[model samples]
Target chain A: MANQPSIHAGVRALARLKKRRRSEAIFRAFGIAAIVFAMCALAWLLGSIIGTGYKAFYQHSLTLEVELTESILAPNGSRDPDTLRRANYRRIMQEAMFTRFPDIEGLSSADQRAAKRQNFDIMSTSGGPNYIRQMVFKDPAMVGQTITVRIPTSDIVDQYLKGNLNVDVPEVQRKISDRQIAWVKTLRQSGEIKAGFNKRLLFSTDSRDPELAGIASSFVGSLMTMFVTFLLAFPVGVGAAIWLDEFAPKNKAVDFIEININNLAAVPSIVFGLLGLAVLLNWAGMPRSAPIVGGIVLALRTFPTIIIATRSALRAVPPSIRDGALSVGASHVQAVFHHKLPMAAPGILTGSIIGMAQALGETAPLLMIGMVAFLTEIPSSLTEPATALPVQIYLWSDSAEQAWSERTSAAIIILLMVLVTMNGIAIWLRSRLEKRW
Target chain B: MTENTSKNIKFTCRDVRVSYSGKEAVKGIDIEIADRSVTAFIGPSGCGKSSFLRVFNRMNDTIPGCAVTGDIRMDGEDIYAPGLDPVLLRARVGMVFQKPNPFPKSIYDNVAYGPRIHGLAESKADLDEIVHNSLKRAGLWDEVKDRLKDSGTGLSGGQQQRLVIARAIAVSPEVILMDEPASALDPIATAKLEVLIEELKEKFCIVIVTHSMAQAARISQKTAFFHMGDLVEYDETDQIFTNPAELRTQDYIMGRTG
Candidate 1:
């Protein structure tokens, strides 16, 4: 031991300490890099979504005063509902458009009607006619009254107003022609067109016209499907966990079951979709594309998640609590229900919420169950045809039109908001139910 | 006290053997416990004293792979007979563990758990009276009277132990078993618990397992010495402590051997 010099020993110790410090620094650098990478990716996703989607919430419209004449609206000069229903309100809208632009009226005979029809097409095909029909039906006596109403502009004009169409691009490649673009500029200068809240996009359901589509039906469908998923998964998962962890005898069969349950949690979700197709749809003959079928598929996918969570929660409760209950003359069932289950309830609830959130965002399984079908009407029952929110976003993106892409991003923003709100509720519930041992 | 000493036998064991997964933990033995008295079982660590005590109320039945053979009877009925429910036996014979294990509930609820499970009370008022009497007997009513709604876990170690005792006695069991009930307490609390046990023996038969021979000598009227899973000596406490019958018992009592 004395052969080595004291100064050499100190130098060696310092060299080892320096090597350890260098490794520790490298580990810290790797951790920081991982965190920064994640944050940057998240920020990029949100920024792109918000930049493209903000315009879809607002729509551009043109205001016009239409003179409803008795000769065109009520030919018989009668107040009958059938006569009013058959009235030629389309001609009135055309006349109104002609009055707004007198240049079209002064054109020669062959050109005048054609020009009028071409200019009037800027308004939504259904919006102008539907407005006049509603007006005359509500009050038949006012056949000559002039009323002012704002109507949605054409989809291309709306996109142009939102700066989606580049005026700098060559005229051949641009969707809006030079004449239509000049007219839109003149209308804006005269204060005849303005941007307002898009109530149609918020209130209406699926539509063939991109300008009129909304997610109301899909939102309702998602709510219904999630409710069913929660109802089926929560109680069943908790019960299975209680039985396996507390009451079941330790044996070879139970050990096999426990291992299989863990493996089921890691299985690809689409496999469950195939299972649902064979078992629930084919064998039971359930209706295709219904929220009930979608919900059942998602419940099967979420069951393993909840079971694993509940088992760990039940295991976390100390064994002394069980002994305490049993020593006081409680039956096995009573001991579990009274002492162990109550203590594990908060953890179980948190797990169920997380499972439900996962089910909400799942798209691949939903697609297999035919939850991606087009639906226009809000579902009134579990058996009705429906599409979920994530499915709506998927369908809109697939079409890839001018305004549909914007609507897809808008739907994505809404989905993220809902997910954030659900997670917030789960956190609040956990805090409220947290107990000190 | 003298009159209570002559009470009839409350528990009878004959050739009782306990095995855990084919390995014997307690060998065959015979013993009788008198009613309304305190019997203490003292032994070295891992000597099967706690296992033998668990056999009285069939608490060992909850452990997987544990088997008990031979006759153990209470009130002239075999405890291990077919159709004999351990639940009923547990209700008749309550237990308190070495460590204080009060349920995560209010003080009133902790004392009320046993009676509630056994359906011993006719009304809420009846339950309240039973809880009140149990806590008073356990010597915790005066210290925790006003905070009946407080959690039992909030109490000190000694108070929590007493709360468990109160909970056990709430069902009005004829026998109460304690497994090193005071080993966790301080000297002052241990003295208080000894006094409470003395008082409790007037109404219920008490069996206690202890590692402290001084504690066994102080509180128990009869003592059993266990060594290496066998009963080395069984006699009156004074006789066993002063004049041990077996060489192993003498060596153990003298702190020379285990």
Candidate 2:
């Protein structure tokens, strides 16, 4: 400052320097602001998902006791768990509803709508039996008496709790007629029809209506597909990665293979679907719409990703480690599998999870392979036609039913939850591997 | 070649040349390595010591278009013999690199890796025993025994280098090739590695590539001087330093032109 120039040119130079500094600060501020914006978006998405999806995991219902009469249960009171399992729980649930609402004096009369609505199958699916069995086992005396049973409510009632039915809306738009709504108000006052966690969601098969649907078969379908993907993709991907990364000569053929793999990674997931439909379904005559076919398609979708990740993991292993192994008189293969692959395990597992998660959420590709159709019966094998959560969301969204929209949101919530759970597992496994390696 | 007095591994060079396509890297080289103990190859920058080291193991095979024309043998068996599997060759003649490389694995696994691959350890418990004993001989057991399950990469640099030495020892090779094994180390680590080398020479025939003439004089029993891709001198380490036969070797030892 003491040596500062008095000339006009020197003054102008100082002014320019200050302007540059101001611009840089502005640039930095914008950069930081952009980062903050991105973080805010991510937090909002996660919060909204957790908020809406939490409801799909639970249900609200009433506990009304209907006597387990001899005609209803064993047709003769044979009280065996296996026999109870075989004896249709659906029928038991239906009869309980009819028995409770015997006041529905006439079936066709609009006057007894309240009594008819009392009959909802809340305890009929596989998990529903667990509650029934518990009650039956806990006190055998309650079997023939008016023991309280938690029966499900109508979809209209569920919508009210789910915020789908706006309270301020006029009676015409709401499914629950104003009279029944007033009755529900009375029940709410009496401490009967309050919203609570639905426990029967996990074991129910997908319904024609999402409000009443369960995910039993779809859950089974996902497990089977993952089993198949794991069996087919993991070993094959790892084997190819090891060979390509460590053993293969840098010849033209290998170069071609590397290029093809990169190209394969870019191929759209729908293209994979077309290939699956043509090969597995049309020409091969394999089981149509089976989880096996869906899995094969998803495996194809996942294979390149696994291979690329494994190769990088293998490469990240320092060449010195390979030298150390070989210097110890280990063969090339020995140096790699015994030394390199195990070192690369954390990377490989992370890749595998990302691949599996992608496959689990994939819909368009599986859709072409016919895994998005009606699947009522529980699957015995991978051959059974089934829908995954993503496919279910897709199917529900396309329907004209207003209730199906809620189902779509519910499906989205479930799918997002599974994704979150998968990512959580990946983080857990990565931490475990990191601690050891 | 057969009538030569020394019963050592000799590299018979008749106009030996190494080239990358058209450009020659190693012009010509000729030398005989003694049968046992430690032999150090000392050279200046770009003198081709590392390139020469790779010629012995044929590690240059990984590089495309890298050509070598020379007859190098072990007990008269041509190392470059057709149908000689590099994979099998590597097992008999092991190598350690400049930087210590421990796999991202437990200390136990790092040492066990080699013995496992060569089928030296028959069972898991047997393998564990080998890794334990190897680490002990490398002067690292006391420091690392309590944390064998911790990743080898988690060790200090010197400890990691020692762990690598243990890994090299685990395979139980007859010859050990080290390419500047302590160059990337601190002084203490270097001293430890040098001490370990002296102990290792008793059982394994060792060859080391180094740039430090002082280190070469300190560790090796015999020293070979390499200059511009040629072996300038080979003699006892003390003799080579005190009285070199070649002018280049004399200049290098005296710090004149090197």
Candidate 3:
């Protein structure tokens, strides 16, 4: 053996080593290229979403003082809430806009009607009427007083003011006429048109007018759906994992069950929606478009992911921990619950959170369950008709309006933020609770 | 076996055998383990010494498809009887493994685990006392007394092994099974463990499986040599090393073959 020549002592060995090093370097370059490509894609996606959607967070509003004509708002002299609510606030708003731009009155009667309608389009259709009604309802004494208030501009004027509309396009091609653009410019010169934080976008419910639309209803629905999903999926998934990993006897039946569970994780999420529609909605007579049903469907979709994650987490715990506990005279139950489960908790929690995040962004199954309904009132209970954030994004993205596109992008940004936050929480929990063996 | 009949017998085995998934590991064997003494089972790897050691406390029951068929009695009680609960039996017979497997908890909790599970200690004070005494007996109290609240996993390998020993001792078991307990330890730790085992045998029946013939000769009173799942020799430690009756045993101890 001592007389044997060393294979590693020559130029051939060095060349072989250099070749191995070069291959490793090439592999590393490929890995880096893949990562760089992924990063570029993500950055481009975020940049486009933010660049188009950030404008939706700020809105142009017209600040004007308009005399509330008592005869128009309270013709019966009855200050009752119902009488005030049913008053002609739209006429009052039109008069207010006409007073702001008096040139519309000089046009011919046939042209004057068109000019008045164009002038009225400068103010938000819903915001002005809702604001005046709320004011009159809150205080009947203010019927004759001139109130200075900030009212949201119509969606077209808002787009024009925010530099989103193409003024270079012919007046016939643009949604906003050149006359309405002049009125917006006059308001801007007088400091009456100001851009401020779009509180309506976050505070109000869904509206036909994009200027008045907000995420409040869909956000609430998402919260409720996620709450139900977590409540149902976590305990059941973890319990099933624990039973299968620690207690179930190793046999053909158990193996078959495990294989089915793994296969269930690979099943398309829409299948769970169909199952929910069949079992939970149709057979159970559950309410449609309700968060409870949506949550149940999402729970069905999420639990399989959670189960796979939890089983892997439980498996990651070294068997020696079980042996250690067992050798100390602990029963199998105690050994698992006291030692193995605690050790597996971090991994399980990370898996559950990731599952929940996936469920939050899910839209197709929700579409099957009728969660795509346009909900205007924020859901007050789990059974109320509701639209989740992803569903809202889907609904808005399908709308045939330029304004809805930006709102859709804004909703996407919000959904991405929520997913990122959930992933952050998952990472934090894994780091905080993970124990070194 | 006849010479040890004068001492109190803790375990009596008749035609003991172990198999994993229908594959025989430990062939039929008959043996008696004396109480309050160190008995060492020495062999090369896969000789079934570790598998046989696990049968004492029914640790083999935890492994899937591993079966032990034997008439094993402890103090005239059939340990393998169907009515016997392994959990209760294990409290009376503790075990330490090859690698230090301390619970990922504080040093104090590691020692208190066995007593807490078996409900041996009546109060926190009693549990603390049990932990202290166990650590002292394991010869680890002085090294870890100041940091009892620190994680057991953070301790050095040697300290971790002693902590595991302390955890086993905290239960006050009548029998202690050590399966190559010092195989992962350095020479100094192994020496310390040998000394601790020497002290432990005065009260507990210590059954150890070791690959080190010198370790067995140094600490054990009775020595059993296993070869190919068979017990080739069982005699006084001195006799087994110096004048083994079987040629296989002689060749193994003399380093002629594994």
Candidate 4:
């Protein structure tokens, strides 16, 4: 009976081990599922952004050949460049549309005007007029000449080409009417309608017309703001970090400062915006809506991040390293600068770059400082009015247009690309500076 | 113990006590370290043997909240004098740690670090010669001569330890302090290092702390026994191993107690 009880205890122990092993396997599966789920979520987000945004990079346009008759443009019959410059370019484009659709020309005068207006609406709001003005400015000699040019189509037609405006939908519910769809089809069949690289959308500033809008101004703004943020944050952040980490004594005041600095990093970013408004704009008398102010505000927000990163980097340097240098007769300053700082450099630089990237995406603080203004020109200096890429994306996303949605997603793609590139550089730099010991 | 050795004293300590954060680590002790000899301190763990060795070079000064008392003089000069700079003092008394802590640099740079900081060498050629001689003295010159540009950390543990020794000697210090220098080495490397230490004693005052009684008896000229932060006994290596003066020292050396 004693031997039997011992054998039974052995079986019970084996059963308990089996139960533990099963739970371990289940935990392993859960971990793998969690990782797969995270990866799938990220992939899904990228997939959707790419799918919708790629269409914005290329736009549909209708190519046409039309006579720029002097009667509609320079009605005075004088080829004076000034008069040509002052000519009615929109009417010339309308006449070109009428020429393309001669059926509209055969209609009665009032009906003809209506048909002409409808045809003109099919062209891009700014591309047709802007193209005429550019040609006239480039060559006054082409006033009476017939030139073939490609002009952007309207957003509704652009949507139709991208299959966003469904033809299967009821005509009343659709942005494009049946007749307009038939005209688009005819143009497509005749090889006149084509998809062209959207140079205007890439080059132009913010516009009410989605087809004419671009992020050029905001890209420059982000560059300038981030530059200023870097200039302010890097030296000050690193200096403060070095002092606090290396020189500060372990007193209650220093301890309190360290705690507050960490807490500052976790504070809501919008609170920084309010502080910037009160300090930089209201009290300091700095210009509002300027990149300089935006940069300062962003620096304040990113300073804590850089400091935290730098202190950790400094801490990672082994105390044995300082001991080695000091043991070799190097002074405290010499040991830190010659050995400790160099060893800690890669980590510091990586942290600074990450902080800069975070500053690049910040928008709420800029909004409080009036960077949400509809800036049309690219900023050339720190003191100029500017808007960042994320703010531009925000502005476009708020517009009530089908094409604006695509542009919004496209801007998001660019932001993500820049962020990825920055992080890649940080990783590369870290590896380059990595030491085995 | 020796009839022909010079009567020069390299270090003299009187009532030296060291404490960390108000906890006394090394109780009051008095000792004199002779010039041009290897003096070893042997004790059990937490006996403050390493702390006592660090007093010679003022290496204990680096630890925060570590307070040192009493008088420690090197070559008739008070090390804790008001006008003395620790940096210059360290150059005079170089140190090698328990673990080999070579900088994350090439072998040549690791040795050149001390000479460069002290400005001991005037030109590149002088620095090169110093590095060569130091490595030679450490018995590491031949193995690393072809690969001086390789990282110091890339070497084997024993090689790295010898490299650290070479780095310490490059500063041309009068006294070199080593803390458990051979505790991490294998039998062959330990034998090689013990031989190097004996040879180094001809030119520099060497103070070493060790855990191995045999190691102390083999290389050191004099051995000091410590227990619980107090010096139990100190004498010539032969007398301490064969005929200890204290009961605790005899018990420790006989492996009867610690």
Off by over 4 Å in 4: A1-9, A77-85, B1-3
Question: Candidate 4: how close is chain B to the reference, as a TM-score?
Answer: 0.97
Candidate 2 A-chain TM-score = 0.78
In the range A200-239, model 2's lDDT, one tens digit per residue, is: 4566677664555766777777778877877788888888
B1-258 in candidate 4: lDDT tens per residue? 543455789989899999999999999999998999989999889999999888877788888899999999998899988899988999988888878889999999999999998889999999999999999999999999999999999998889999999999999999989999888889898898999998999999998999899999888888999999999998888899989989999999999887
Which pairs in model 2 have colliding backbones?
A58-A198, A59-A197, A59-A198, A204-A214, A327-B94, A327-B95, A329-B91
For residues A26-78, write the lDDT of model 1, one tens digit per residue: 99999999999999999999999988887889988888888898889887788
Q: What is residue A375's positional error in candidate 1, in angstroms? A: 2.1
Identify the superior model by TM-score, candidate 1 or candidate 3: 3
Candidate 4 lDDT over A225-335, as tens digits, reads 998899999998988899898888879999999999899888887888898899999999998888888888899888999999999999999898888888889988888
- Looking at candidate 3 chain B, the ten consecutive residues that score lowest on lDDT are B1-10
Q: Note the B-chain TM-score for every model.
A: 0.98, 0.91, 0.97, 0.97
Model 2 Cα shift for residue A395 (angstroms) = 2.2
- What is the C-alpha local distance difference test score of candidate 2? 0.74
Q: After superposition, how far is residue A233 of candidate 4 from its true place, in Å?
A: 1.8
User: What DockQ class does candidate 3 belong to?
Assistant: high
lDDT head-to-head 1 vs 2, winner: 1
Order of models, best TM-score first: 3, 4, 1, 2
Computed on alpha carbons, the lDDT of every model, listed in order, comes to 0.88, 0.74, 0.91, 0.88
Best model per lDDT? 3
Evaluate every candidate with DockQ and list the scores: 0.65, 0.45, 0.83, 0.83
The TM-score each candidate achieves on chain A is: 0.91, 0.78, 0.97, 0.94
